[model samples]
Target: EAGVAQSPRYKIIEKRQSVAFWCNPISGHATLYWYQQILGQGPKLLIQFQNNGVVDDSQLPKDRFSAERLKGVDSTLKIQPAKLEDSAVYLCASSLEGGYGYTFGSGTRLTVV
Candidate 1:
């Protein structure tokens, strides 16, 4: 089966700039998640969606971040007026069940320059 896919691999932007990342989950997978991983720290769940409906987005920084999954396939996350502290690896993952280990994309590593 194909794994989750993410784009850009890396990104560099100044504080307050806007950036966007894309993700494509495996076929047949019904759950998708976006996480922010800072260096040396664990991945923190930012948003989760079951199909095209939001399941959990409590951790997402709504002030500057937004995401959506249309048609229950590909998803996109966007950040506007990004902060220096927001620079981190944006990882996309999919799992059959929330209890199972997720398959992660290489991630979009964002660096605030």
Candidate 2:
């Protein structure tokens, strides 16, 4: 089966600019997640969505970050007025259940200049 898909594998943005990342999960998977990974650090869950509704977003920086899963399939994550500190790899993952059998994308590497 195909794994999760993510676009623009790499991105370069200026500080204060906005960027959006898209994701398409494996067929039939019901749980999706967005994670941020800084170099040398483990990926941190930014948000989790079950179908079209959000399940967890406790670590998301609500003021500048946002995400949505549409129709229980595709999802998008956006960061507006991005800061230099936001330069990191953004990962998209999907699972059949909340915390098991996760399939992650190659990741979108954002370089804030």
Instruction: List per-prediction Cα lDDT, in the order shown.
Output: 0.93, 0.96
Candidate 1 vs. true structure, TM-score: 0.96
Clash pairs, model 1 backbone: none
Candidate 2 lDDT score at position 2: 90
Candidate 2 lDDT tens digits, 6-113 = 998999999999999999999999999999999999999999999999999999999999998878899999999899999999999999999997999999999999
Each model's Cα RMSD = 0.9, 0.5
Error of 2 at 24 (Å): 0.3
Residues 1-113, model 1: lDDT tens digits: 88899998999999989999999998877899999999999999999999899999999989999999989989999999999999899999998876478889999999987
Residue 37 alpha-carbon offset, candidate 2, angstroms: 0.3
Q: Model 2 segments beyond 4 Å from truth? A: none
